[model samples]
Target: MNDIVPLFGFTTTPLELVSFVLSVITVALNIRQTHWAWLFSILASGLYALVFAQSRLYGDAGLQLVFIAVSVWGWYQWLRGGTAHGELQISRLSGAGWAKSALMWLAGFGILSIFLKSYTDTDVPYMDGFLTAGSLLGQLLLSRKKLENWHVWILVDILYVSLYMYKHLMLTAILYALFVIMAAMGLRAWNNSAAVPAAVAGS
Candidate 1:
């Protein structure tokens, strides 16, 4: 749809460009370990919900709404989550932490995919659920300042790129491509940030 200039259906629409701009800022804030990232992500997702709905990507559209809720929780978590610190700091997830994350993602993916396949006319149920569940975990991890969140984002972003292409949303596809690269950069930034102690920084 991005390749064409139609009256609707991503043709002449500026949503993709808007989404890209918001996503870029979101990734940048994420790289700085700023809780503000979730704010931008939420706004981007709100726009994406409309785009996906127009494209009949029902599950993906619904997922964007979930992102809105997750962003709120993530924002609250980042602001005053740990004790009386008043700010959270980047950190690594422990072994059990990774395990719990894995289990939740797997279970959510399986159940959500099955439900979507049965309830909606979506073709790639697994892909939708996979991206959704991974994003949920990544967002939660990011909310807690866990560096491993980037890994989840990288994986989902790659898959999402292909999915957008499959839907003929070239702009969305390109945006996900950028997301993958930014996730990689965020990994480096967050990892380096983890090396410093939260008690010392002027966050």
Candidate 2:
């Protein structure tokens, strides 16, 4: 871990720098609705797993592994999970879907937080669990090309920024802040894409 030294004259590790660059590229591609984002996600998540592990954020480290798997699944889903011909399309979650998502997030948060608090020496189990649960939901939604995935990310990223800051992960906190902005841009881009068909038909 200490093999790679200072970055940009900051005390940042190589793992953190690599993860940050990959994450930024991943989100940028995601905002453009490109399938290549998953590749970056896989790499970024792996590095982040190490970063979180070193920070003693066990939950988040495990979450990064899950993110890697989810990234692979998302890659296939985006390529072949759409209506007719394997083309993914932007869609909104229904009320029922929202309720289900909420239930899942809450349940995950509760269960994971308890486990973390009981089994780990981590000081921020609740916050870690919260972000992990939300990230899982956001990943699922993104895989399905749901428009509201960006909304999930927006909320999750804000909380993550705060948590990372509290943990003295300034670079990670900044990354999460960038995530918020990218998520908003993604929301707008998907919203416009979703409306294109309607506008054309109405015209």
Candidate 3:
């Protein structure tokens, strides 16, 4: 694990470095609305599971496994699940969609937080559950091509950076900070794309 992997003047394990790079690549690809992002996400999540396990963050470790499954689903949806030509088109969530997503987030947080507190040795159950719930909804939105996914990620990633720092995972923390920036770029890109259609229809 102690192979030479440079991370901003600090050295880290190969697993951490690889996961960090994969996460960066995945989010960068996502910002471009590329289906290939899921492929990178699968690898990143697997490596991160191991990393979190080593850190004794069992909830986070489990979440990474869930991320692997979500990545596969996201890949299929992005490539073939759509109303036209089997390729998904980007779109915004309606008011009803927002309401449902909010409900899902709240329910997931409550359930996961309780489970973590009761079943795991995790020190920050609520915060971990918060990130997990937000990420689940964000992944669902991304798979469905909802433009709001980036917004969800922006909120989640900001908190995640601090969370990882608390756990002393500096390399991964930096990676999440980059995720924050990429998510912002993604939101802007999706907004511009969504606006183009509206402007054309208006004209």
TM-scores vs. true structure, each candidate: 0.89, 0.93, 0.91
lDDT of 3 by residue, 69-127 (tens): 98898898888887665777789889999999999999999999999999988889999
Q: Which stretches of candidate 3 lie over 4 Å from their true place?
A: 2-11, 198-203
Error of 2 at 5 (Å): 4.9
Give the Cα lDDT of each candidate: 0.83, 0.90, 0.87
Per-residue alpha-carbon lDDT of candidate 1 for residues 14-116, written as tens digits (9 for 90 to 100): 7867877898898899888777888898999998888888876777788889889988988888888766856776778899998999999999899889988
**202 Cα displacement, candidate 2 (Å):** 17
Instruction: For candidate 2, give the lDDT of residue 121.
Output: 89
| Model 2: per-residue Cα lDDT over 99-187, one tens digit each | 99999999999999999999998999999998899999999999999999999999999999988888777788889999999999999
Estimate the Cα RMSD of every predicted model relative to the unseen true structure: 3.1, 2.5, 2.8
lDDT of 3: 0.87
Residue 71, candidate 3: alpha-carbon lDDT? 88
Q: Which ten contiguous residues of candidate 3 have the minimum total lDDT? A: 193-202
Error of 1 at 179 (Å): 0.9
